[model samples]
Target: MTSTLVVIGHGMVGHRLADRLRELDTAHRWRVCVLGEEPEPAYDRVRLSAYLRNRSRAALSLVRPDFLADPRITVRSASPAVSVDRRARTVHTAGGEPITYDALVLATGSRPFVPPVPGRHLGNCFVQRTVEDIDALSAAARPGRPAVVIGGGLLGLEAAQGLQLLGMRPHLVESAPHLMPAQLDGEAARVLQDGAARLGLHLHCGTTVVSVDGGAGGLVRSVTLGDGSVVEADLVVFAAGIRPRDDLPVTPALPLAERGGYLTDAFCRTADDRIWAVGECAAVLGRCHGLVAPGYRMADSVACGLTGHHADPLDEMDDSTELKLLGVHVATFGSTSGDAGTAVEVTFQEGASRYAKVFLHRASGALLGGILAGETGSRADLAPWVGRRPTADLESVLFPAPPFRPLSP
Candidate 1:
């Protein structure tokens, strides 16, 4: 007896879920149907900025070349899931096609949050989310022209770098006091600011975009800041943030998070057992994980549940991350900052480029959270030790033994 499964959105996390179910369901107990909004199949979204340099579609693809040919799976590109009728166990597509399913998974992912500025919808303004968005931006940007990227976070900085590669002078604007507020603390962000400057991006932190000014041709010409400063821009790219794509199938009965997203339990199951959500569209424990790491974990858990295994409730997730942004290395493990009574901080800096900070419980000597900027040579060794107890000596815990440890009691 084969059960039909309908997966909405074919992004990386959605594809991972589909692949996992197929691999584990050896008895052919499940048949899968995937509906993707984008014309292209799943690709490496983390490497999206890199597409500006290479301009090759195949380079960013996440699908195995021959995997989609499986008879048990059916994929439809450019077909988005418009609605899900839980009562009838059917999904409606944008093309007016109805897909029946025994189980449904929502992987609608998210869309870039473009601020409602006056001229945002004008020409030469783009949001960095899909391949088409980047392509349109590339075509609109000209060499040596001034470009404004409205965000100093990871994606915004990446977009600025991509604009630079296209021979455009880039300016980065951030509403927060510093860049990467979610990942790096104030000090770490200062060092990262210096690194971004070295990469040829002019930065403006602690400012808000009041409005975008357009030229007579209905194209963006400049942006006005809160302090009455106007920056001339030939092209503007918005990488401010993301909002979950939750408005579909008009299901008001489904549980939703505070902001937006399908509220799911530990196993990524919604109030309706037959309906499950994963990826950016899933809000678990009242928190929506925007990053891919947690999404992958959720997909793994869902697969385990569907395959007749008792999926253990997730106790914790390794949200620790280490990645290079705009020629700077940034890593955050466990916690980025500590404010508890037992919090104790230790910091280590080398030369002018590398910085590391660690927080631990003063009484138990257990690791709390940390931030690392510049050269992160020890991140590989440090991140794994998070949440564990260290020796009586705190200095050794802050800095690990030379790359490969000597290992002593």
Candidate 2:
């Protein structure tokens, strides 16, 4: 008898789980049903800013052509799971439909963390998450108008750049002393700041927004910083961070991690053997990973377990990231920082444009972690050497010789 597998949420990671299961279940032992809250199918959220340029939904879609045609897969868009009955093995949808399943997977991703501040509920304030949010922002953005983007991390920078592309003057605000504090150190952040400045992007670091003043018609007029200074703006975007979506009404109430997310074991399974959690909604082994790489790994692990394939538990997760922000290359891998007693730190700087730092084990030469800015050509080469010693010399790995150049005659 074939079993029914119900997957809640159809974001990237959720979609990936369904795809993996379809590939692994060659014997057709299970039927899959995916429930999504959004009306549109899963798209590449990491490149969401690209929508500001072309405004094409199909360009960002992750769905395969044959995916919807597969007889074994059923997809229900705009249908959010309202509650789960563990004892009955049933999932209740918002549309008053109950789905019975042999196995259930919760892939309900996350939501943007908007800070609790005065005047935050005013019009013109937005959070970048779904396609609908982007459409609203695009419709409100006007040329030469002042806009303020909260948070200087990856998402904030992307939001600021998107506003700039819409011909708005964007001012980035970050509570941290430097930009991307979670990934890049001060020096590397400085280099990235310089690059951003060259692109006409204004930045305000080391301060928090205390209040957002409203104008007529309940629209945003200006935002007050922690230092009693104010930045005039018509638009405000909060990209501070994300909180996992683990508030679904479960019959017995699923336990959450300290930081928030469905608590799961290394196998991505909850206390009940019939249910599992993946993606940002899952907190595996008391820790929640906010990146897509780890979420993909979690999805794979669960798919393998359900398909009766031997799979490794999700214990070691790779948090490495490499991307370009405002034309500046930035990459971080493994452990980027360590106290003086635990590890040795090596740094290299070339003027104000390039900075690189690597942490190595004190006793052995094994690579621990590293940060790269301005030039990240070496990221692909160094990613494989993360937890092990490099085959080549350290200098060669860090500062690879530039391509052979011929002298001008």
> lDDT of all predictions, in order shown?
0.84, 0.90
Instruction: State the displacement of the C-alpha of residue 386, model 2, in Å, after optimal TM-score superposition.
Output: 2.5
lDDT of 2 by residue, 32-108 (tens): 99999999878888888998899999999999989989999999999999999998999999999999999999999
lDDT score of residue 166 within candidate 2: 92
The reply for model 2, stretches above 4 Å from the true place, is 401-409
TM-score of each: 0.94, 0.96
Cα lDDT tens digits, model 1, 312-371, are 775566677788877778888887558658778777765446677788877877788788
Spell out the clash pairs found in candidate 1. Answer: 83-249, 335-369
Off by over 4 Å in 1: 391-409
Tell me the TM-score of model 1. 0.94
Could you say which candidate leads in lDDT? 2
- Per-residue error at 330 for model 2, in Å? 0.5
